[model samples]
Structure formats: C-alpha cells, structure tokens
Target: MRINILQHTPNEGPGSLLEWAQANGHQTFVYHPYHFGYLPTAEETDMLFILGGPMNPNTDLPWIKKERQLIQELLDKDAPMLGVCYGAQQIAKTLGCQISEAPAKEVGWAPVYRKSKIVPGLPEKLLVLHWHEDMFEIPKHADLLFSSNDVRNQGFIMNHRIVGLQFHLEPQADNVREMVVNDFPYIENSVLNQSAADILKTPVPEENKKTMFKILNYITGD
Candidate 1:
C-alpha cells in the first residue's frame, strides 16, 4: 500500500506511523505542505496521514486552503485518512464543522477517555500526548471516539475509514523531545500543560505504540 503523510513541520514527522509502515512493508511518502506547498492527489494516495502542527486550519494561507481542498477531494472518495491535532481541525473545518479555541491549551501527557468502540481493544482511558490550543467540533454524522477533560473532541471516526485524533499517539521518544524543544513556548504558564522535563523524561508507553498501530490497522482495513 502507498501510505502518504502530510507533515506540517520538520519537528513533527510521522514517528510510529512510519515505523508501522516499515514493519508492514508499506511504501511511505511524506509531503511538507507548509514548507514545500505540494500535496498528493486522491488518486495517488492509498492512505493519508496528516500530522500535527502549531498553525490552525483557519490561517489565511494559500497552502492551508490547498490542503483543505485536497482533504475534501480525498473525503469525497472515502479515502482512508487519519488526521492529527491541527490536521484533525482541518478535516473538521472541511466537513463544515467549527473550529474554536479549546477551553484550555493541552500540551503534555493527558488522559483521553474512549467514548465509542469504533476501534476495539482501546482502554477506557488512555494517556496520550497533546499539544494544541484549538479544537474541532465533531463533524456531522461522525462518531465521537475520545474526549479529554480540557478538550471534548479528542477523536472522531467517520465512514469507518476516516479518523481524526486531537492528540499525539505517533510520537516516539525522540519525536516527543523534538516537539518539546521546538514548541516549548506553547506550554509555558499553562496549568493544564506539563513541564518539558516531565514530558520528555517520561518514557513513551508501549501501549501508546500498540494503540497507534491498532488504529492504523483499523483505518486501512488490515
């Protein structure tokens, strides 16, 4: 399978998702639309994974608009896609859902409760890494999958193929460190946020990788 990733920043690459693809022998390609201003068409994408970023979907940028158009094109085909954080917000906005500031910025390891059994075997509550100030409203006809105390729309699943997660489950240890180092300012002076040292020192749980792989498998019809 051809797994195409839309990465927004150098620091935020496809961490465990790349790992999963490699272990499964799937071909992977990544596009940096924020930097390169190019995106894959729906015909070229067997599966699409949109990674997180600091920018919101509503940003008045040409590449943002193009990316949203690509998202809509892929959705029209019911392509297998997974959007993370800002990527999720982009998907929500394209689906005619609202994007607003979260009650509080979530930038650390936080617990998200599973609200639906769309992806079976997820624990009732799972600790996942988060780093975003904006949140997306669940799209119409989409099933809410997870929720955190600070963010109600942690995840959503639509058509059993498209998935949107507002947290970071694909980050490995180095990926987390890079995010902490590059985006440190977002966590400062926030009660809901965790310290950089704490966020980095804590080991990436084994279950996090397993759950990510599980979601990948589920989305791709493995």
Candidate 2:
C-alpha cells in the first residue's frame, strides 16, 4: 500500500506510524507542508496520515486551505485516514464542526479513556501523549472513541475508514524528545500541563504503542 503522510512541522513526525508501515511492507511518502506549502491529490495514495502541529487548522493560511481540500477529496472516496491533534481538528473543520479552545492546555502524559469499542485494543484508561490547547467537536455521524477529562472529544471515527485522535499515541522516546525540544513553550507546571523535566523523565507507555498499531491495523483492515 502507498501511505502518504502530511507532516505539518519538522519536530512533530509520524513516529511509530512509520515503523508500522515499514513493518507491514507498505510504501510511505512524507510531505512537509509547512516547509514546502504543497498538498498532493488523494488519487495517488492508498492511505493518508496527518501528523500534529502547533498551528490551528482553521487558520487563514493557503496551505491549510489546500490541506482541507485534500481531506475532503479523501473523505469523498472514503479513503483510510489517521489524523493526530492538528490533523483531527482539520477533519472536524472539514466536516462542518466547531474547533475551539480546550478548557485547559493538556500537555503531558494524560489519561484518555475509551468510550466505544469501534476499534479494539484500546484500554479503558491509559496515559497518552498530549500537547494541545485546542479542542474539536465530534463530527456529525462519527462515533466517539475516547475522551479525556480535559478534552471531551479526544478521539472519533467517521465512516470506519477515518480516525481522529487528539492525543499522540505514536510518540516514541525520541519523538517525544523532538517535540519537547522544539515545542517546549507549551509545557508548564500547571495542574494539566506538565513541566519539561517531568515530561522527559517519564517514558512513553508500551500500551500506547500497541494501541497505535491496533488503530493502523483496524483502519487498514489488515
């Protein structure tokens, strides 16, 4: 399969998603829209994976607008998609949903509980990587998959082919480091946000990695 990845920033990447794609013998391509400001059509790719970023998906940027168009094209075809943080917000915006500021910034290993069994292997409650102050509403006709105390609409599934996760389940140790090094300004010693020292001290949960693979398998029907 040809998997096309849209990486919004240099620090935030595909993380464990790259491992799963390579392990499954799937060809992967990455597009850095922030650097190049380009988005390819969905016709050439078998699947689309959108990674996280600090920018708002509803911003009046040309690339963001193009990205939304590409998402719509993919949705029309019911193409398989996995969208993280910013990616999830893009999906919601494309589906005519509201994207607003979260109650609080959730930046650390926070608890995300499964709300539906739409996809298996997700634990009832587990700490997942989170780094965002924006929240997206669950799209119409989409099933809510997971919820966090800080963000009610954490994860959702649309048409079974598309999945949106507000948390970063694909973060490996190095991936987390890259995020911390580049986006350290968001980290704070608040009740919800964790300090940089604490975030770096804790390791990425093994179950989160397992859940990422499960999500990939479920979306691809592998």
| Cα TM-score of candidate 1 | 0.97
lDDT of 2 by residue, 4-36 (tens): 999988899998999999999999999998898
Clashing pairs in 2: none
Q: Across residues 2-120, which tens digit of lDDT does each residue of candidate 1 receive?
A: 98899998999899998999999999999998888888988898888989988988889999998888899999888889999999999999999999988887888888999999887
How many backbone clashes does every candidate have?
0, 0
Q: Model 2: runs farther than 4 Å from truth?
A: none
Report how far residue 8 has shifted in candidate 2, in Å: 0.9
Q: Candidate 1 regions off by >4 Å? A: none
Candidate 2 TM-score versus the reference: 0.97
